[model samples]
Target chain A: MKIEVIVFGMIADIIGKQKIEVNNCSDTTSLQIKLTHDYPKLCQQKFVMAVYKKVITGNTNLNNGDVVAILPPFAGG
Target chain B: MLTSKEISRYERHIQLPEIGIKGQELIKKASVLVIGAGGLGCSALQYLTAMGVGVIGIVDFDKISETNLQRQVLYNANEIGKYKVEVAVQKLSRQNPAIKFITYCTQLTNKNAIEIIKNYDIIVDGTDNFATRYIINDACWIANKPLVFGAIHKFEGQLTVFNYKKDNNTIPLNYRDMFPTSPAVAEVPNCSDLGVIGVLPGIIGTLQATEVLKIITGIGTVLAGKLLFMNSLDMEFYTFEITPDVNRKNISIEEYLSYDYGQFCISESQNQINEISCKELKELLLNNRNTLQLIDIRDQEELPKVPVLEELLIPLVEVIERVSEFDSSKKIILICKSGIRSKLAIQMLQKKFGLRNLFSLEGGITEWLKN
Candidate 1:
């Protein structure tokens, strides 16, 4: 299943855009692996993944058209 | 028990049926402590003072720099060199003479975080660094205060209420549950160079004031377990549910005191050295003590000596002079009192001789005693 991944803050700088589509990602783990492989710099960044607007702690199955938001902690106020 | 003058002063708020006289009184009786007098603090303080929070505390050690003039609307050119908390309290007092203002000019440290936070009914996080953010979150968790967290980066901002008590069925989410660990400095450096839109903090900070008012009045649903995301470029707002990390256990005062958040964040980006936890080190020592060289970086006179390892003693100051003593071919471990100095030792070795076989004992001997 293909999912749309949206990134915010400095993660956008690493991913080079606000949104990117990943194909054939079955779970959150694979999605993260693919993201790390594609953008090696994301390996050191601390961020949370929101699958369909809900933050998931552990791996969860992803369906097609899911919007996964990569939210990094902003060090500014 | 609000004075007639207070009721008249808050007549606009009192007239609303939802707020009424009781909610207005609640606003007059509430006390809030806002950390950091930067963009977010300036905006939040303006409304919190005008709206008549009973007593407010301002914590900031920064001076008003020329660059702050754009977003921090509270100060003028003449006040540029003045302390932020001093100027903030002065201006806020003038805005609302009824509300009390307490100022803490020193930076918040672990030693004073709990004592200072316990006096206030609510805490506002407007800090700009990851170390202070983690400290504030842990301090609030220990003090049992609800934290109104707000952060901005470039054109985006995040706002939420952490550790707020909700229904019995739901567990509230704290900052740690959202971002378990602080990001390395490489991932996020000083934001002054990154640049945030001048108005971003004003908008997000005002929203934080709204949450505080709602929480005090007990009128609207609070953002307890929800994270609010805002993107100024797209002008869109999205809400995400935050799940508590089942593995994230409660932090004890002892554990909180020993953890060096500054070093923790820096250590990750500092050469990315391999760390040996106390538990892991203990298991490895049982078998690999002869194979691994353990070096103590503390002074020889330092107490709590572990004679079992038969470790070599080399003070941090003398590590460079005795560089030849370490056998890089075998795995080497550095031990210190708090584990912080050991990291410095590893960094020193990597920089001088480019040693790759160095590991720092996590939490040092203090953690070993606990485990």
Candidate 2:
């Protein structure tokens, strides 16, 4: 399955882009594995993954055209 | 019951059918505890007070800095070095005489989060650090109070309400549910390091205040079980529904007390690091000559740069990443605006690099220049 990914905050800075496309990403856990494999710095940073418009803590099935938002915790007020 | 004067003051709000006299009374009865009187706190506090929240509790231990003027509009140029909570409460009290302002001029820690947060009906987390954010979340969850959460980075802002009760069947999501772990202290940058547009916090903080108002007045959909992301530049708002993790441990009071929240900010263990007095350090500098390395681990903007010492500048946050820049073979003295950050820098050096050649200057550069 192909998925569209959107990154925010430092994650965008790390990945060097706000939007990207990943292929054969069947689930959120595998997507995380593939993402960290390409952008290893993400492994050290803390963030949450939201599929479409819902946040998921564990592995959830992903379909084609699904938008995955990589959101990191913001410390500034 | 609102007095005639109170009714006249909030006449516009009372005129609205959704928030008539009954809603005004509910607003007057509600109390909100806002942690951290920084950018978000300032913005949220202004609206919350103006909306007639009866009791407003503010918690902050930071002093007003010149840099803060860009974002924390609560303080004036003359108020620099004064405690934020003191100035914020003083100004906000004048904004609403009917509202009672409870000022806590101290940092919110594990010891005080529960006791202080339990007193208020809702918790507004405006803290600028991840450590305090988690502490606030855990405390609010344990106390069973709704938490209005807002945080900003550059032009982007996030707003959410956690542990909120609505129609109540499925449990509400807390901060831990969204981000289970904290980003490494060294990797994360704050407002100071990465500049944030001043209006970003105001926008997010006002949204947070709105959530608090909705929670109190029982109107509109509160931002519970979802995260709202906004970009000031693009003017876009997107909310993501959050699902709870069954595996995450329940945050208990005992677990909170035992957890070292300070590990994210500073050292918690006994101060085993060596310390040198200003006079002694001067003598050592004079005798050791060029052998010892004098490193000022404070932000460059900090005043009274020691031209005589010619210390190397490396801010505390960059200490871990810049460890290779320090020559561990030589005796290195770290100096900061106050002595606290220098000690933390030294700890970082020792912990990350295992370098024992580090020493913290007693009283920091401010004391050193006093003589």
Highest lDDT model number:
1
lDDT of 2 by residue, A1-77 (tens): 67999888878877987789999989999999999999987876788899888887678999998999999888899
Off by over 4 Å in 2: B263-290, B293-327, B333-345, B349-355, B359-371
- Interface RMSD against the true structure, candidate 1: 3.7
**Looking at candidate 1, what is the lDDT of residue B195?**
68
Q: Which ten residues in a row have the lowest lDDT in candidate 2 chain B?
A: B262-271
lDDT of 2 at B67: 73
Write down the C-alpha DockQ for each prediction.
Answer: 0.58, 0.64
Can you write out model 1's per-residue Cα lDDT over B1-371, one digit (the tens) per residue? 88899889989999999898999989888999999999999999999999999999999988997778888999899998899999998888889888899999977877678889999999999988888899899999988889999999989999999989866786877888977777643344446645689999999999999999988988788988899989999998989988788889889999888777773334444758778898888888888776789898776666688886456898776787798899777789888876767776777677677888899998788778876
Model 1 alpha-carbon drift over 4 Å, by segment: B263-371
Q: Find the candidate with the highest DockQ and give its number.
A: 2
